[model samples]
Target: MDKRINDLKKMYMDIKIPDNIDSIIDEGVKKGEIKMKNKFKGNLIKGISSIAAVFLIFTVSINASSAFANSISDVPVIGKLVQVLQFTGNKAQGGQVTDGVDIGMISLRKAKNSEEVIIKFNKSQDNIAPCYSISYEKYPYSMIFTVSGVRKFSAEKDFEALKQSNFISDSYNIITLDDSAVRFAINFKKPVKYEVKEYKEPAQIVLSLKECEKGNDKAAYIVRTASYPQGETLGILEERLCGFENIRIVKDDKGTFAVEAGTFESEEKAKERIKEIMNKCGSDIKLYIEKREANQLPKQMQ
Candidate 1:
């Protein structure tokens, strides 16, 4: 046995060694690692691209179909995404929709104490005119908002959403008339006054619902600086009117939004306010006086 072991040791020592063996092995290992890293990066990019495509499809589905938007809105986790998606263009509803107009989703934007029901129209087709009318009904108290050139499923996917709102009453519904139109029969819990405004860009209609304020009706004189469309948003107008007293925006029946500064009981006081405003604002500034039917006086800040 000892003689055999000695012979094996002699044979092992007789085998020649390569001087470049370490360098060769290191080069091979480095090549293998780089190949693996490149493979990993390719897979990662493909996966991200696939995910982006799915999300794009999902967003498109939401935009093109109101039923899908309503379905996703009820979801527990992704409910907030509905806020943005509901407003996207639905101009691509191909054949099944009505003849004239393509209606987008109807979303109820609720705030701390107010609610605005928004109805969007696919204004992509310039050939179709988006026209609507507003009327009031009593006894049951319904705000009849009739839109021309629309059908039933046009934008009515979310009437249940309006029903769920604390600000609105039940049985708020949509009625499709024989004349290529749909009427939003919004029933309220109590008598309410609404201000309707038209918007561009996305082309939408907003209904600002205000429950009737009950108290006393008195003559409140208003000094209106400039006349803008009724229901026009006061975006940065207040910033321009800085250093003014009792500044608030009011809408008159003539469908104009005017910057009202200082409430007065008499026309004489309103005239004095107009003088003050002309002095502060440009002398060429257009100013006028109007009387607001008394509800609670608007809260005034300096």
Candidate 2:
């Protein structure tokens, strides 16, 4: 009787599902027959006690499983269901809610920074706007880009705007740059005259450096509002220089020669002279514009 008890104990301990399943299936079939025999051979009270323990364990397991399923079903909507299962049992902290249609759960790989977090949401199409937002745990700023709806393919500026083009704006705490103080060197081939005119008032004038030169002494003829093409402008420039009134030749520090004209008293008089010259010079030479004496007058003359 002792030998039989020892054999039954060995059978109970040894009959396990094997790592290699085919072998485990074969062993299970053999063990099932032995277990059946032992059931009959064992004392009635011990057999009943063992059966009761197994039933209790099974009942507890069924109840626990039902409770878990019930908890999952209590989620609010399909979107919430997808969100809950997104990390496959892992919970996402600081996860955002998106606005549009959600297809399913997507696995997010581990990310190092907020930029990576924004990229992850961008990859998922539609509903991305409401679903995701970015935050750095230790940092004060939050960063994110939201899409309003399904994006259609186009070569418009709208698509370009979606890209992380402005890094400063993407970060929460942004320092603004002042571009107002920037200055650059501007060059012009022909002389330009600047005037600040307050309607019907005597205008203040600033002359380009070229207007200060002296050379040819002829009076200039000017025309108002004439458009000059590139090919024809050179001829007009030459005639203006040659025909200018009280033209003078001046020498620069570098010994370059320059042609200057006019110490005319008023802009109207200088323009009248330029117009007379334009009529003499003809239409083949394009006339771009005529500046008032106020603009063309040298600082010494002013």
Which model scores highest in TM-score?
1
lDDT of 1 by residue, 1-302 (tens): 99999999999998888999999999999999999999999999999999999999999998987656765773442211111212112111111222466667677866445667877677434323265655554323455565666643456667778886665764333323245765556666665656666554555666677767753436677766665543324424544565776554443334344555666889998898778767776676566676655432222221
lDDT of 2 by residue, 198-265 (tens): 11011111111112233233333223323222223323344455655433222212322222343344
Give the local distance difference test score of model 1: 0.58
Model 2, poorest ten-residue lDDT window? 197-206
After TM-score superposition, the amount by which residue 157's alpha carbon in candidate 2 deviates from its true location, in angstroms, is: 32
Best by lDDT: 1
- Candidate 1's clash total is 1
Q: Give the TM-score of candidate 2.
A: 0.16
